[model samples]
Target: MVGRQITWISSWKPQRRTTTSNGRTPRYSHWVRYNTFYGLVFTTTLATLLLMADLIEWRATGYLFVLANRFPGTVALIVQLLAAFFGLIHVAVVCRLINYALRLRLRKASVTLDVLRTWVDMSIPRIDWDLPLRFFFPVLLVVFLSLVPAALWAGSITPFIDRTTTTGMLLLPSYEDVSLIREYPMEIGTSGPSLRTQKGFFTYSVGVQHVGNLLSSAASASSSTTGKRLVHPKLDNTQFSYIGRSYGVGAPAGLTDMSISSNSQVAGYIYQEEGYLCNVTCIYNRTSAFRLRGPVAEWIYEASGNLPDSVDSGEMSAYIGHTGDAIVAIGVAHSERSPRRYLALAAGPSYAFLNSTQCALDFTPHLFNVTVDIANLNISVVPANPIPDFNPQRNLTRTVMRQFELLSNDLTNLYVSLLGDALNASIAAYNMSRPPNAGRDPVSVSEEAATLAGLTNSITAMADDMLAAYASAQLMVGKTFTQKRDVQVYLYGLQFGQRVYIYAIFVFNLLVLGAVAGEAVRTRGWRELGRFNYLDPRDLVIAASRGGEGVAWAADGLARRHSKKKKGAGEKRKSMKHVWLLSDPDEGNGSLSIRMKGDGEGHVGIVVRSPLFPPSPDPEKGERGGGGGGGFEDGGDAVDADKRAAQREWDRRRRQKQRVGLFGSM
Candidate 1:
């Protein structure tokens, strides 16, 4: 191949013999073809540029002008529309041709005299012009039909974004409404080590347990008592990425605060100490902790509404467990007819962490008020107690429970507002201000910015009104924010018609392209069938795994059965095998747990294993196992079961990693 390539190169080189002391002369035909092709390319390119500029100007000003004033009449409109259509078609044809020629050149031979000569000879002056005619004719027909009065039917059209906007939600009336309602529930993946799974959920992250080691002296008098050995689950020594790690109070006593540092996904935290809650503020990233060293403390006093027995002009001091501790202070409002009763929750090492937790807590609560009865409070605790070694276990429980109750109520109310009528009203009001427009319209940046600014101002004003309503409610119920509300506002406004037009265009283009492709396939037969042969090579492994026999039984979907047969002598009739099926057991108390290596380094799973396994001969093996493996009296070794569980975890992690890697590459 190298020799052939060398020979080819030698032959292809321009000959010096034909150009003795002078450059070779250009052929007239070559010059003519090159000029003609480039002239066409240049003209098409100029037309495309002009069309784009015109469209943009039209969108900006909501007015179309081609060389000054051209009034809106069917004739002038039709001509302009036709020109735009043909111009777009011209671009498509040129682009496709360029792509095809480049591919051909790269895959076949380089530029050659024979190839150039053939292109010139075979080229038809009007052949590339077919696309313009095709695009223009259909557009012209549509325009003419549209102008007919009969075509203007009065059909109600659903707004475009309605498809993306989830339904059955009540919109929040205001920011204070957000505080009153709960945010909707979003599926959150959990993380951590030493977490156990039961009924499909992993329950732990940085699991905290108080350990007391007591040394007993030799007994003298009556009878001697030996201390029983205490045991606690070992923490998993795995630290996944911040996106996977779950943060909790490392220590419950001292200045126990949990915050996300700057370098990590966690931003900051505010936590409780062992004594009277101290509210100190600080800024932090990942590595270092900076005290709210700001001359002014970042602390806000929350009113407990009780005058201390020792009164030294005490304001509503936040119960910070100890001095110099940072915690999130959130107001919780419950409703009878109107949302009234309020409670404040404080627990954090930094504001950011507190805010995020507050947001997470608020999600479910905010949504509930919007959709259901505000009086109904359902709390699902993520059972991770703060570091219990420093603080008395009893005090820790009370503080944690109080914090959870207050936070849960706030979160629920926030979620309810987001999903309730308030959101719907907001969307409706937003859409009403601006309707969509189709017909190859153009947009202007300055005009759009002005419109957006006006909308933003209006939304701000509305939000303030909402806050006032909440404040009034708070006062009536006897409570308020200690450091006035500094609420962050977000506003969304979308043009309905334009979005619809774009969506319709996309769907129409897809259908038309598919039809064009089908027609092209029919016209060309199967000559280019090799183009679709590409595959990932990973999918094959997935398929094989699914196809394998003796796949792990999950007691869901397809069921497996054992076959039994009777052996007989040659003279006797042969007995056929009968399949014995084990029906999937009903949902029972028995559980199945699954843990993955990279997935928060913890376990997550559902329980479906049955309690019907017969007792094993080895009693030690039967009761020595844990969870699902121990539910049945199987004589399986504990280590072996653990190994199997670990392997399953590894598989799950591998699959998750593969998915993430694939998406990243995309």
Candidate 2:
């Protein structure tokens, strides 16, 4: 039976093939003729431009470069590790896609070869062995170019982000409890002026009058002294009296009351100590007859009151007789024997009358009785005449009279000389008891009085000075004090290596993120397989066809069988029918045989020559003539060949259709 045959001729021409000077097309395309140079240049330029842009952005931000420069070794190590990790993933993806593409191309070539063998029974004449290199190198170049940004990002920018973020987090405002110490000296003393003396005197007089009158007179006296007094008095006899106590006698009647003058200013008194003094005076408003008890001598002597003329209750007058001639009187009289004694005595009644008085005055009467032996003169005066029944008044007047006599002797030369020695001794003792340059001890009233007593021959000056000094000291001792307070201060703001570690971590994380992003962009969301799919199918097919022996044989058969051939010369070229080749290699050399099938069978068969396999032995050649063209003639063999070819063709057609459908969907 005759089988129908269908021939397939390639409509696609190989553009890379070129004819040589021998007028024959070369088996393989020239390597340099492919337009890979432009692709290589374009890809390289694109990569370089992208790298430059990345560098520009890095320079504009400046942080990455700065950090890298600051810690180059550290940054370089970290960047290398990061690049390695990303490069591994990139290489794995690229390799996987390239491998998959290679397998797919091989499978496609296998299917095409199966189709040609089953339908046409032919193979190509030659294979382009360098095809795989052309396809693979371009893919490798593109993949390599895509990885540049990822590597750059990993090396730069990441560390800066980490460092800045960590530093910010660590830099916060905080506080701590603290204590502080400080030292200083405080001056504790009186705030105002230095203390001074307030001096005055008092007097009392008793006459032949009612005791009630005396009490009333005392009650009428002023509470404090009113007149000015001396600050520092000299020890002299003409200015002060220290001789005897005297009383008025042989006066008018009706003076029946005892008068008292407390704190009266005494005139003609010499002050021999510092601070204030009080002298008492009693006035005889009415005369009363009085008598002297001892040493009665009638003599007129000037009596000067310590008060001013305007405030004095009475004028200076002469006293008649005096008694109680104490030894102090002889000393004063001896010291007053100078030529100017009378002149001083004449004018001493009015001195320092009223300079101005401070209202805040304190009055204290300090009385001291001091006695010292003098080698000047011996006084043995016995009272010549004495009045027995004339008792003196024992009131304020009597006390003033006695004090006046004592103070008078205090100013004597002998007393002054002795008092000076005593004051020098006291001062020397006080100085020896204290450190040099130390301040004086606070002087109390009693202390001041003692100090004055050591210097004065009378107790009044001692008492006054003691009272004033004591009051002043009290005001000075506790003038001010010290206390403690709290204060705020700043310590440290940041410490330790916290800043270094925080910045390092922050920059590291940021760099990693940048690396991921760059990688994603470069690989188009990590779709490496999809990216590799952009390789040309023709290139892949040629590579597959070149690499496999089965595909190479199929290509060779197709080239040889499909080429046009010239007929013998001089004979009219008979009309030639297009021939198709098919084969069944499973039948060994017999499988290489072909048979014709009728039109009713819907297939054609042709025997093709193969350099790889020997021709099959023909049954018709044995019947007709042996050792001739070996062609198959049995209907059974034809039937078997046709059946096998039809089965393989069907499978090839199905596979081709599936491949076409898949391509269409894509």
**Best candidate, lDDT-wise?**
2
Question: Against the unseen true structure, what C-alpha lDDT does each candidate score?
Answer: 0.24, 0.26
Residue-pair clashes per candidate = 79, 56
> Candidate 1 lDDT, tens digit per residue, 1-666?
101111111122322213222222221233432232343343334334434433342221112222213343543455445434533443333333333342223222222212222222222111211122323243344334333211111000111111111112111112222232222122244321122222111211111111010000000100111232111111111111111111121111011011112111121222211111211111112321111221133332232321111123222333222332343333322112222222222333332232211111110111110011111211111222223233222222222222322322222221131111222233334333443441234652333333233323222222222222222222222223111211111111111223333333334334434543564466342121111000212422332232221112322111111111112243453332211123332221111111101011111111121121111122333433223332221223447666456435534543342211100111
By summed lDDT, the worst window of 10 consecutive residues in model 1 runs over 213-222
Q: What is the number of residue pairs that collide in model 1?
A: 79
Deviation of model 1 at 211, angstroms: 63
After TM-score superposition, the amount by which residue 17's alpha carbon in candidate 2 deviates from its true location, in angstroms, is 49
User: What's the lDDT for candidate 2?
Assistant: 0.26
